[model samples]
Target: MNQGKTKKIVYKTVLHIVLIILSVTMLVPFLWMISSSLKTTQEMFASPPTWIPRYVAWENYTYMLQAAPWMRYFGNTFFISALTIAGQLITCSMAAYAFARLRFKGRNLIFLIYLGTMMIPFQVVMIPQFKIVKILGLVNTHWSLIVPGIFNAFGTFLLRQFFQTIPKELEEAAKIDGCGYPRIFWEIVIKNSKPAIITLVVFTFMNTWNDFQRPLIFLNDDSLWTLSMGLAKFQGTYVTQWNQMMAGALITMVPVLVLYIFAQKYFVQGIVMSGLKE
Candidate 1:
């Protein structure tokens, strides 16, 4: 008994040490980003990378705002992310529910086709997508970004898997009570699938928020540029302004970080729940 207790203690101690090391490794880059953002130009390029800046130059942030259309970028990013998430949630949830519970013709074959698209690289289709967007007169508009993301194959697949795990007895009970499909879906399935929905929201927000390629390809006007695109331009124009660049980068990450912190619990729970057998 004593030997077994000692072995368990040693195992826990080793596990704790490994976790601590991994945590520090993950945090180092972010800590460096924040530290460099607050440093002066000279301090940023000092012989050894400074773990902490000698002086915290708050002016770096103010200067970044003055140097670019930061406010416009922020607004554009928020608008795109909000619209994309709204469309994705509605469309993906409905599709997922139908695929999971409802019987329809060629259902498996249609789902297989949808899954097949996921294997196709985005690069292979970008030129074609651009041509289609231009033909629709949405090339320079936010609709270009919003429209493509609305019918996401991955979101549908994820939610379908989660919905399949839900007990059919609940749906049967709702049916007996004279509840329609929409009513049952909204009140029963969606309520129980909060974790999965939150997971989708977090993913959609992060992807749309940080995306640069789509904005660069679709938006030609500077005023319509998202934060990621604006930041890329800022980096190129102010190559020497490491401080300001870091500040802008940090500002860009704020919304995503805040969202992750809030939704992290549901994100983890959803992942675990999705993997378990019903």
Candidate 2:
């Protein structure tokens, strides 16, 4: 038993070492960006490429703020992300509950077809989707982003797997107590699926938050632009403002980081449980 415990300790230690190395490898670029954000333009392109800037320019943050309407971009991003999360949670959960629990004609076949949409690349449908949104008069509006993102096939598939994992016994017990479909879904299934819901929330929120392509194509006005678009403004025809852009990039990364920090526990659980086939 002592020898087995020693081997387990060794394996765990080695795993931790590998993870730490990988984490540092991923963090190097972000650290470099932060360091570069604090350096002058001259210092940025200096010989030998200094990882640590000798002189930190705190004014870069102030300068980037003054140069662009970052606060407006932040507002747009926050609003879009919040709404996108709500929409996905509602629509995806409902669709998932139907797929996983409700019985109907061609239910499995319909779900399979619905799930197949995930196999289609976004680029293939981008133009047609834009046209549809255009016909709906949602182009250049935030609705273009929010509405499209809400009813994700992958989100439906994800939550459906989670919803299916729930025991049928619970539903039967609830039905005997005079509960309805909607009531059981709300009180039993949804309440038990908090981890998966949180998982979807974190994912949908992050994807919507960082989404660059949809917003760029859908929005033309600067006032409605997201942080991704605002960051692009740092790149000029001739010169790219590396320092200011990095500062802004750092700022843009904060909310996602905070979100992960909050939802990280459920994040792993959701991923694992959603993959378990019944």
TM-score each candidate: 0.91, 0.89
Per-residue lDDT tens digits of candidate 1, residues 1-68? 99999999999999999999999999988988899899998888898788878888999999888889
Ten-residue region with minimum lDDT total, candidate 1? 269-278
TM-score winner: 1
Instruction: Tell me the lDDT of model 2 at 155.
Output: 85
Q: Relative to the unseen true structure, what is the C-alpha lDDT of residue 52 in candidate 1, on a scale of 0 to 100?
A: 77
Cα lDDT over the full model 1: 0.88
In model 2, where is the ten-residue run with the lowest total lDDT?
Answer: 232-241
